[model samples]
Target: MTLKVGTILEGTVVNITNFGAFVDVEGKTGLVHISEVADTYVKDIRQHLKEKDKVKVKIIAIDEQGKISLSIRQAMPKSSRPVEIDWQGERNKNSGLSFEERLAKFLKESEERIQDLKHREGRRYGTASRR
Candidate 1:
């Protein structure tokens, strides 16, 4: 099969390293970088992939040197992917508030958070100075 960018293919994990995993797809080996292994952060590649594990990978890039870059996260079907929450849309849905009102509320909450943080920092330094 011709490997093109955006092509999703099933592959076997031939090897795993600290940086990424080598996958064999249709007789060609591709590198699935650690960041491309999952939608969430992967602290250790071994936690997500193991040698001989079958994985579906999307062809993200093909370098001039013929190196293929694959992504397991992108290969996943959209139905199985996490739905992105629109914070503003959700807030407006329930509150029925205008944009200006939302903006004012957000500013108030932000200022309150900043003041709370400043108070906590002051307390920490105040106690530390006495030691």
Candidate 2:
């Protein structure tokens, strides 16, 4: 069966290489690039997947060369999804900070960043780099 983008299909890892892995989805074949295999940094693909491993893959692209780019990252379940957001953390009006206070805080942060850059430049070029 032909796979389209955003289509999630159950696949079997048929082969593994340093670059990526080939998956067989029913009669069709799809390839999940090493980068698309996981959300976290993957130094080695072997550590995450093995041959004959069943994986759910979302078709991300289909090139003119008939390459099926798949994403296992989107197919996999998120282990820790944030259930509730703490409204106290929000910087909006609900945070009890007035708009003017928020603007002043923003200006303070901007000034701090500018001062930090100036300090870094002074240290790097002995205070003569600005000229």
Number of the predicted model whose lDDT against the real structure is largest: 1
Q: Give the TM-score comparing model 1 with the true structure, all chains together.
A: 0.69
Which residue pairs collide in model 2, if any? none
For model 1, how does the per-residue alpha-carbon lDDT over 17-122 read when each residue is reduced to its tens digit?
Answer: 9999999999999999999999899999998999999999999999999999999999999988999788988766748778788899889999999988887897
Q: Write the per-residue lDDT of candidate 2 for residues 12-115, one digit (tens) a residue.
A: 99999999999998777888999999888888999999999999899999999987888998886656423567675674644677878888998999999999
- Indicate the residue-level lDDT of 79 in model 1: 83
The lDDT per prediction is 0.93, 0.86
Candidate 1 versus truth, CA RMSD in Å, comes to: 5.7
Model 1 residue 121 CA deviation (Å) reads 18
Off by over 4 Å in 1: 86-131
User: Per-residue error at 17 for model 2, in Å?
Assistant: 0.9
